[model samples]
Target: MNEVFARGPSLLTRLCIVLMLSVGAMVIDTKVDNLSTLRTYLTSLVSPLQYIADLPGGLLDWSASRFNSRQKMLEENSRLTNQITLMNEKLQRFVVLEDENNNLRELLDAPVREGMYRMIAELMAVDNNPYSHQIVINKGAIHGVYEGQPVLDDTGVVGQIVEVGTTNSRVLLISDITHAIPVRISRNNIRMIASGSGSLNELSLNHVVHSGDIQEGDLLISSGLGNIFPAGYPVATIINIVRDESLPFASITAKPSAQLDRIKYLLLLWPPDIAPVDALSPSDELTREGS
Candidate 1:
């Protein structure tokens, strides 16, 4: 134990030895090529250790780059999705506008008799009561629309206004069960009453004699007798004629000329005597009403 604890050299002696060894190593490294070869071998041996020491930094940088690339990709995907949704909404709006334009053009081209004033009206709401076939229009008394005013479409008569408000009015469709119009057969001028059959596509002709000259293909026009509807407008077409000798009148069914189920726009007309002097144009009235 004493030998293990004994000091081999004094502190000054050790310092002198270390200093002389360091000076000799420096002289050899500068003058002789032997130390250079040894240093090359030492560096070669330590190359793997140097790489191992830097591995964590290299791996961290690689992972950070991969994470950034993925984040950028996700952001791009989100932006593209939003853009696509916006484009689709715009496309749908264009389609609706195109349909509205076509409907307006057709309403403008409908036949109008001389001395009659006409204006366009759009449907606002439809009556959901199954018992009544009625619709609401954007025109009202404020716009010179009155109760009993005739309503029509591009093809023919639709109905008449029954109720009026300041900004809107109710129209009773010709297909309503309580509605009736005097019609004349275009072929032989025979007059008959075309009444609604409570169906959008059917009307009943009342009191038709079995021997009447009416046929299945005959066209019916307003006879201008009741003073409710104008003359020469198409009302309905005779589709079926059932003669029951057991009954007094023949059962006849006709299809209305107006597309009552699909109409979006309507025409309101005023006779020359009843035309309003202060009535605005259809376009101007619509803009004002909307605002």
Candidate 2:
């Protein structure tokens, strides 16, 4: 115990001796490569110990990198998701605009009468009742829309206005069960009444004799007998004609010329002498009415 407590050399003396030995070794290593073989052996012996000592620090570095990479990936995924959502919304808007542009172009290209005044109107709502095929327009009495006014699309006649309001009007489609239009066959000028079959694509010519000259694929035009629709406008095309000796009238079915189910924009027309003197052009009139 007494030898252990008694120091062999003073602190300053030991430190000075250690520094002298380190300097001597460094000088010998620089002068000659005498320590090379010794160093190689020492490194071989200490390599595993060095690796063991640095293991915790290497593990910590690897863990930090993995966590940071995961965080970056999550942020990138969220950013890409938001960008895709915005792109889809823009694409939908572009599609709607394209459809509206196409419909307007077709309406502009439709043939018009010499003395008739025309304006464009947009559909606001459709009647919910399944029994009635009616649609409401944005124009009404305030826009000079009146009851019994003729309505048409780019292709042909659509319907007539049944009720008028201050800013809206109800139109009875020609496909309604109660609707009928006077039609004349373009082939033989045989006049008949084309009644709605309660189907958007069908019209019936009731009370036709078996000896009628009507045939399939014949074009039917307005006969101008009702004074509501003008003459020469295409109404329907005969698609089926059944001649039966057992019935009084042959069963006749025709397809409407206008696309009633897909109507988006319509043409409201004022016949000759009915249009106002200051009536605006179709484009200007639609803009004014919409505003």
Those runs of model 1 whose alpha carbons end farther than 4 Å from true positions after fitting are: 1-114, 278-291
Query: Model 1 over residues 1-291: C-alpha lDDT tens digits?
Result: 988767599789999999999999899899998889899999999999999999999999999999999999997765554344333322422423443455458788776544345666778999999999999999887778888888877667799999999989999999999999999876667999999989999999999999998899898878778888876677888999999999998999999988999977677778867666544333232222221
TM-score of each: 0.57, 0.58
Worst 10 residues of 1 by lDDT: 282-291
Candidate 2 Cα deviation (angstroms), residue 231:
1.0
| Overall lDDT per candidate, in order of appearance | 0.79, 0.78
Model 2 ranges with Cα > 4 A deviation: 1-114, 277-291
Best by lDDT: 1
Which pairs clash (backbone N, Cα, C closer than 3 Å) in model 2? none
